[model samples]
Structures are given as C-alpha cells and as structure tokens.
Target: MSSYEEIASPADLHADCQAVSHRLQEAAVRATRPAPSIHFDERRREVPKRGIEISEAAQRLANALHLHLD
Candidate 1:
C-alpha cells in the first residue's frame, strides 16, 4: 500500500495551502466591502379604495359600538 507522504508530497500540500489562503483572503475582502444601498420612494403607497359600501345598519352598529367603547 502507498504511504500518506507518497500520496500527497510537500509541494502538493504547499500548493493546496496557498490556494486555501488565497480563497480566504478573497472571502475576507468581499466581507469587508459595503453592501449596495436600496432606496424607497418618499411618497406614501396609495391603498385602493374599497368599492363595496357599508349598509346603513352596519354604520349604525359601528357607531353604537364606538359610543359604547367611549
């Protein structure tokens, strides 16, 4: 059977270490960079007016409930 040293020589290990270090440096640089800014419109979003009108009975009931709560 082949030994561990034979499978991965010193040169191979050094190259692997260099590749890993380079990747880590790239990741660190990406992490340090600021994220892009997102802007929201200053105007308020207009909600669609409800098409259905409340019945007179519902309005009276709501008024009664409001008076009771007050």
Candidate 2:
C-alpha cells in the first residue's frame, strides 16, 4: 500500500512520514551538489536543422544561471 494508506494506527503514521521526509531531504542534498563538468565540443558540429533560435525563457534562465549560451 501507499504511504498515506499504509498508516493503520495514529502512532505508526510517523514512520511513513519520516520515510518520506528523509527521501525528500536526500533528494534536496543531491540537487545542491555540483555535478561533473560535461564537455561537449560541438562548435563545429552541424545539425540537420536549417536554423536554430534561442527561446526568451531559455535566455532568461541562462542569464540567471550565469551561463553564456551564445
């Protein structure tokens, strides 16, 4: 059964709650850590597409992340 349904008694409910909380905490910690740099030398690589256009939202996100996707 799912976590919300597995709780048979009021006292045992905390165990499920703690499990979910711990999982969320672990996920948060993993997200905060820096990932290894992914090197992609696609400067000269050509795509099948005729042209590409950067979206306004993507530009904003790049600026916010201090990334230069030029």
Candidate 3:
C-alpha cells in the first residue's frame, strides 16, 4: 500500500507487511473466473404468466425434472 506505517520493530513490521502481501495475493487469485463459462440473457428471468402455453415437449421435460427433484 502507498499509505503505510513508520514503526520501530523491523522484524514484526516485515511479518505484518508479508501478511498483507499474502492476503492481497490470495484476493487476486480468488477474483478470477474459469475460462469456459456460460452467460445467459439476464433479462428473461421473470416468471411466466398463468396462461402461457408451454409446448408439450417443454411440459414433459419440466415435469420429468420436477418429479425427479421431489
């Protein structure tokens, strides 16, 4: 960090600085995603209306999934 300390104990100061550096390194590692990932049309997330006519194939698929999960 640009903003840091001016303390006495150099050994403890080195340990503290190493701890901070290690934390920053771990944070950098975590802030990444896998190469092959999927994204969707986020706008199409609303629940379907009551009378929306799902196709027979879609209905069968949904029912199969629902039955298995339950």
Number of backbone-clashing residue pairs for each candidate, in the order shown? 0, 0, 0
lDDT of 3 by residue, 18-44 (tens): 999999999888887456435566446
TM-score of candidate 2 relative to the true fold: 0.42
Tens digits of per-residue lDDT, candidate 2, 1-70, equal 6677654786667888899999999999999999865667734467677788999999999989999677
* C-alpha positional error of residue 51 in candidate 2 after TM-score superposition, expressed in Å: 44
Ranking by TM-score: 1, 2, 3
TM-score of each: 0.49, 0.42, 0.38
The candidate with the higher lDDT, 2 or 3, is 2
Cα lDDT of all candidates, in order? 0.80, 0.83, 0.74
Off by over 4 Å in 1: 2-6, 40-70
TM-score of 1: 0.49
Model 1, 1-70: lDDT tens per residue?
6565467878988999999999999999999998765555744579678788777787788888884321
How far in Å is the alpha carbon of 1 misplaced in model 2?
Answer: 20
Q: Is candidate 1 or candidate 3 better by TM-score?
A: 1
Off by over 4 Å in 3: 1-6, 35-70
Highest TM-score scorer: 1
- What is the clash count of model 3? 0
Worst 10 residues of 1 by lDDT: 36-45
